[model samples]
Target: MSDQATLEVRNLQTHFFTKAGVVKAVDDVSFSVGKGKILGLVGESGSGKTVTGFSILGLVDEPGRVVGGEILYRGENLVGASQERMRQLRGNNIAMIFQDPMMTLNPVLRIDTQMIEAIKAHQKVSDDEARQRCRDALGQVGIPAPEERLKSYPHQFSGGMRQRVAIAIALLNKPELIVADEPTTALDVTIQGQILYEVQKLCAETGTAMIWITHDLSVVAGLADEVAVMYAGRVVESGEVDGVLDAPQHPYTAGLIGSVPSRNARGKRLQQIPGMTPSLLNLPVGCAFKTRCSYSTPVCEAAPVLSEVAGGRQVRCHHPLATEAV
Candidate 1:
């Protein structure tokens, strides 16, 4: 990892102010992504992984906002940045590939029109040059007959095809940082592999930093340089991908690994983590995962702060699991 990171998120707290109560969507979450590296944000749905990505890009809507913390992009804080400033930075310095392709695609606009507009918005490129770049991007993402596809509208494409276009668009400008929220979940295995390879190549060649948010551990194991496992709006554990995945310290992380198909015997039922995630509005007294974790102790009644354990891994647990669990 580089000493000077491309992005550093420190003590981030994004909360939703609802009529019933304030929901802490992302609480005290922190991580960093070095240039030319990928950080996997892995967590179940509603674990605040997606919200964390949105918080980074300044995309959190009203009633939900980054209440605290510093989102430092090369040392520049993004919290409370002007809308105009964020607009100028987006699609150039920073780009986000949302979970929904429609968030990136316009139903009425031709693919080429939207792609060309995106390029011209941040750079001084001629329409012809921009159009060619658009065609090349589509081709790079495994889209066939790029020239013909460019003429088509978003609604004309299948869900998976439209997602490919959305991924293509995110790569068009070659932003320094990309926040992708499960961009490949909709793709078939063959297409997903191609996208993964291309993304790895893009970062390696262009020094791009990325935060790939997904619930799939298999994807993270192969693609990410580092991984942060989140639970109940907080990162419960984080470290190099191999170290964490092979012998997870946090019980939540261990449970997640145990539940994967490859970890269990054939014909046997899958291992399950006990209980459901606690509601953010009515969180327990201390550690959020305590209710579900088998390693919980009296110390867990008071929140266990994320601290470095052996092998330089960080685990938020009063009693972390042993290697025997593997």
Candidate 2:
């Protein structure tokens, strides 16, 4: 990872207003993605990882909005950018890959048509030039016989191939940043690994920063340069991937890593976190993970702000586990 930060999210708070109550989906979450680096935004379902990605892309719909904090791309703040400006930015300098391929691909249009239109939408390129770029993008994503694949519609491709097409479309503009929300979750292991390798290669080659949002820790272990572990709408711990995984200081982070099957002793039952994630609308007053944590004390009733710990990691816990103990 380089010293240059491509995207920085500072104290972001995205909330949903409902008749029941206000839901702070992404509360005070913060992280930065360096150029050509992949930052894994890890959390289980409803932990607000997806919402965070949507907020950055300005794709949050009605009843939900980015209420606070700064979303700085390069050096400019995008939190209050006008719709026109956001539109100009999206798919040009920034792109998003949804968990489902269908979200990025149109069932009715041929692959070449969609890709060509995507390139032309961002740049004033000729049809031939756009087509060549589209073909090259498809090849970059490991799609075989890109020329023939371009003529096929979305349904003609398999699940893995369709995802490759989606990724190709996202790369069409050579975006500086890409927010991929579990794009490979549904694919077979082999295909997923292939896609991950291609994506890493692409980022390195193009200097594209990426936020890979996923609940899978193993995926992050292999793919990310840095990791931010989220629980109940807040980052519980964050640091370099190896440091966080090998010596997680936060109880929540340790619980998550311990739960991964590969970390367990051979032929032994996998460890599991003690409790369910707290509801964002009605979270506990203290540390959100206190109930699940073994080291919880009365002091945990007051939320702990993220603090720098050993090994340059950050943890938000009153009773952080020692690195050696973990």
Candidate 3:
């Protein structure tokens, strides 16, 4: 990323100290989101994408911990930061939108109550002032009748509306970096599109960097400037969204792109990766993706470091596909 990057995760490794052994939930992950740029972290379930987001926010709970590497937020190392310091940054400078609306909302409390407390948690603003900010936030996310909605409880709103409220709270602080974990996955197509548009617009208008975590390629296609593809616990491919999606450097990435329904022939069977993702606890000796890649060679028996290819794209594969051929 450029000097204006809001977050730079370098060789991040978050592990779970299980009774069986240490599980490398996120291993050697690295990426950066520059100011106003959206970077999509795309992968299947259990690919460690969510863990990466939690590690960034210092939310990894007991039995799980950030084991190695640096999580640099605007050149400041967060790996060793104290809880108070992280709390100070959580809502003021960094905010996260969870996958579930209930994770953010209190079922019993009115929307106004939760949102006002959130604003007051980090800022010394009058309740009236904070309430107005909350009202504007709801309006920003396209919620109609903000004042009426603020009086409603969490159960009063639809799933989409609840999600919008959560997003509004995340933005209420005008954070520098927002880590959103599949924020639109639960919404309908129409609602998701509207939310995506609002999010993209907000980032551009506010110059806030974001890391959008999701398994959906289509969402990233329309919203992200850059994308990082993860397999198992590592980033297998990363580059500009168009370049990587159009001519995927890694076989796993190509597989993911091919599997997307819209990209395939209407009557043709969908393409699928050959095998299941390897268990992180007992990952293969070398390239974690080797077991599922038909293009794997003997070189793949040894772990491949994330190396740069043409056009500054990075791929963790001994045999990256030829861009011209793709």
Best-fitting candidate, measured by lDDT? Answer: 3
lDDT of 2 by residue, 1-326 (tens): 33658999999999999988999999999999989999999988999999999999999987999999999998889999999889988999999998987556888889889999888877898899999999999998889899999999999999999999989889989899999999999888999999999999989998899999999999999999999999989998999999998888988888888888773388998899987888888999988888888999999999999998866588999988877856
**Over the stretch 17-121, how does candidate 3's per-residue lDDT look in tens digits?**
999888999999999989999999999999999999999999999899999999999999999899999999998899999997756688889999989988998
Candidate number with greatest TM-score: 3
Model 2: residues with Cα > 4 Å off, grouped in runs: 1-3
Candidate 3's TM-score reads 0.97
Instruction: Write candidate 1's Cα lDDT for 232-297 as tens digits.
Output: 999999999999999898989999998889633988888999999899999998999988877788
Model 1 — which ten-residue stretch has the worst lDDT?
A: 98-107
Q: Which residue pairs in candidate 2 collide?
A: none
How do all models score by TM-score? 0.95, 0.96, 0.97
Residue 294 of model 2, lDDT score? 92
lDDT of 1 at 166: 86
Residue 286 CA displacement from its true place in model 3, Å: 0.3
Candidate 3 regions off by >4 Å? none
